[model samples]
Structures are given as structure tokens and as C-alpha cells.
Target: MPELPEVETVRRDLHRLLRGQWVKNVSVNKEKMVRGSTSLFKRNLRGLLVQGVKRRGKLLIFSMTDDKSLLVHMKMTGQMIYQSKQTLVGGGHGQPRVKRDELPNKYTHVVIVFGDGARLFFNDMRQFGYMRLVNAKQLEQVVKRFGVEPLSKAFTPDKLRRLVRGRKTSLKNVLLDQRGVAGLGNIYVDELCFLAGVRPMRRADKVTDREIVKLHKAAINVLKRAIAARGTTFNSYRDGLGGEGKFVRMLKVYGRSGKLCVRCKTILKRVKIGGRGTVYCPVCQK
Candidate 1:
């Protein structure tokens, strides 16, 4: 699944390309890929002008005229590709890769046509992604379901401390909770913990105040760097321009289990937390 960085990358590209363009048509190849009535969904999108694209957590919000929006979630194996006569750009899980010539390929479950004949394809190899049509009120409710955006003004050292207070779960699990920290995933949790010199398995309440400050800083630093690098691509991730993220090379312990730690020369170890593989350096993190 594309995390905040990857999703935000896509949102940025799409917002730039799709904004001000009128929806020429809406096609739903797979009914299950859409959340509401297919006809209503198509009706709501047709002819609507895309006002902007916004993201909260991993959800992409396409704001359009008439108080309508498209809420898209590229769950695990989904990809959003935009194509015009002059450009082709997209990003998501890159599995079952799309052949440019054979676009609207078997994996493309949804396609949005713009007034200029450009098209946006929503492809999912595993059919786990979804698109929903929503009104302003519905959009607000959806946004409210997520926690603080790490990049937003609402997230700070004090806010981070409050969010983790009283949590008995491992720091990994606490960070992964979307209700607490909106955009963190397994990859980032491991990296941030390592950067903070803390163990992912440490209990949230067990973390010291000083450690909280470190964690808060590390979280922002890691996320900002990852976003700047376009995000980490491991097997199945691409950026908005159909490019792989360069951040993978900067990863410390996320996928480097059994490797030597850069800081302490200790061997990195991997463990299962909340069913997700987590890697850390025992010596450095201790």
C-alpha cells in the first residue's frame, strides 16, 4: 500500500493535471471497486470540474464543483495512472504493471475521462482498492476519522506525547494506529524508532519524555525526507511520474534485517509486531 508520501505524491501530480479540467465521462469497469450506486457515482462525476486534490492519511480526496468529491483509497495493489497526448504519469503498487499501449488493461477497474480527452485509470491487480462519491458533509466526516497529519501544524512534540500516553501496546502498534498518527505505517515506524534510538517493541507509556521528543523529531524528519525522496519503493511502489521512489536507498532498518547497523555495527534484527515485519538494531535501539 502507498503510505502518506507516495499517496501525497500522487495527489500532487493529479491535482496539477486534473484541476480545472471538466470530467468528460466516468467509467466503472468493476462495480465492486466503487462504493456507492454505480449510476449515481457516474452521474455525480460527469461534467464536474475538478477543483483540487487533497489527501488525509492514505486517502485521496478529489474536490470537484457542486460540493462533490471523490474519495479514493489505493489499498494494497492499486495504481492511479493519468495519461494525455503529451504525458503519462501515475504511482501506486506497481505490480501487474500497466502496458502503456494496452492501457485500460485488464487491471484497470475505473477510468475517468476529462474534457481534453485525457484519462485517469485506477488499476488494482488484487481488486482491493475503492472509490466513493461523497458530498461536503460526508467528506468532513471522512476526514474526521483520521488522526493528526504529521506534516500539519496540529502535530507537535506535545501532541505526540499526548497521543501515546496511556497506550499499553508496543510503540510500533501505537504509531501504526491511524486514529493516533494519521499517516505512519510499518516501514516508517521502524525507521523513526531506529532514528530515535528506541526499540519498536518498547511500550508506548514506557517511553521517556526525552525519548518522546526524539521520537517526535525523528518522525517529522523521516517523513519529510521520505516525501522529498518520493518515498521508498520495495518491489511494488512508484511515484507520480511513473517513477520509483529513491528513498529506498536511504532506509536504515526497514528492510535490512540480518544486516549490520550503521550506527553501532550491531547486526539488525527482525520481529513481528502486529503481524507486520519490523527491523531494528538491538544495540543502537537499546
Candidate 2:
């Protein structure tokens, strides 16, 4: 799954290539990938100019000139490819195609054609991604289920503490919960816990105030650094330009089980926490 940094990178690239572009046509190869009524989907988006692109959590928001916006979630194994007469950019997983034959193989689910002959392709090998159309103002209602954006100013330590207070769940599970902190996946959560010196299995309420401050900083810092490095490309994630992220090389703990800890010579350990594989240094994390 593409986490916050990966999603943010896609949002930035799509914003550059898609803003001001008018939608001439919209095609859905897979009906399940369209969230709303097909008639309404085509009617609302066709002929509308894309004003801007923004991201909330792991969702992509394509603001249109009309009151409606397009929301897309590229779940696991999903890819978005942009093709124009002069350039080709693909992001998500797999290799990019610069030629017609190079287009996404059997997994192409949705295609949006622009007036200038450019096209954006949404491909998911597993058919898990989806697109929806919603009134711009209703976007909040649609995404209201998610908690505060981890990178936003509103996600202070107090907010995090309030969310986790008295929770019996493991700290890793709390961080992975979209309702507790949006946009953190397993990899970043493990990395964040390692950096904060908190064990993934520690009860949320057991984390102290000072440790919460450190955890907050670690979360933000890990995400910011990952975004700067274009996010971690462990299995399938890539940027909008179809480039694999370089942050995987910087990982301190996530997939480094049994490897020597960077801070201490102790070997990192991997264990199951809340049914997810977790990695941390036993010597460094409490």
C-alpha cells in the first residue's frame, strides 16, 4: 500500500500535469472501480476543467472547475499513468510505457482522456482501487471518517495524546488505525516507533507525555524525510513519474529484521504486533 509520502508525491505530480486540463472523455473499463452511478460519473466529470489536485491522507482529490471533485484511492497494486504526445509519466507499480504497446497490460481499469489527446490511466492488477465523484463541499463528509492528517498543523502531540489516551491497543495498532492517525502504514509505523524508542507492542496508554512528544516528532520527521526521498518503494509503490522511491535505502527498522541497528550494534528483531509484521531494536526500543 502507498502511504502518505507516496500518495503526496503522486498528488504533486498529478497537480503539475493535470491542472487546467479539460476532460474530453472518461472511460471506465472496470465498473467496480467507479464508486458512483456511471451516468453521473460521466455527466459530472466530462468537459470539466481540472483546477487543482490535493491529497488528504491516502486519497487523491482532483478539484474541478465545476462544484464536483474526483476522489481516487490507489490501493495496493494500483498505478496511475499519464501519457501525452510529448511525454509519458507513470506512477504506482511496474514499469512505465512510452509507447502504445507499452501501455499497462491487462490491469488497466480506468482511463481519462483530455482534450489535447493526453490520457491518464488508472491500472490495478488486483482491482482494489476505486474512483468517486463528489460535491466539493461534501468531500469533508466523505472523508470525515479519517482522523487528523499526520502532516497537518492540527496533528499536535496533544491531539495525538487525546486520540490514544486510555486505549488498550498496541501503539503500532493505534498508529496504523486511520481513525487515530491518518496515512501511516505498517512500514512507516514501525520506523516511527523505532525512531521514537517505543516498542510497537507497548500499550498506547502506557506511552508517557514526553515519549508522545518524541513519537509525534518522529512520525512527522519520518514522513517528511520519506517524501523528500520520494517515499519507500518496498514492493509496488512508485512516484507519479513512474520512479521507484529511494527511501527504502534509508529505512532504519521496518524491513531490517536481524540486521545490525544503526545506533546500536544489536540486531533488530521482527515480531507480530496486532497481526502485522513489526520490526524494532530490542536494545534501543522499550
CA RMSD (A), model 1: 1.0
Pick the TM-score winner.
1
Model 2 gets an lDDT of 0.86
What candidate 1 gets wrong by more than 4 Å, as runs, is none
Regions of model 2 farther than 4 Å from truth: 94-100, 235-237
- lDDT of all predictions: 0.90, 0.86
The Cα error of candidate 1 at residue 102, in Å, is 1.9
TM-score, structure 1 vs. true: 0.98
**Candidate 2 C-alpha lDDT tens digits along 1-286:** 8889888888888899989999999888788999969777977789999999988888888998868889989887778788887777766654333345466557887889998889998888887889999995688797888889998999999998997799998988899888878899998999998899999899999999999999999999999999999888855455667667899999999888999999998999989986789999999999
Question: Where does candidate 1 clash, by residue pair?
Answer: none
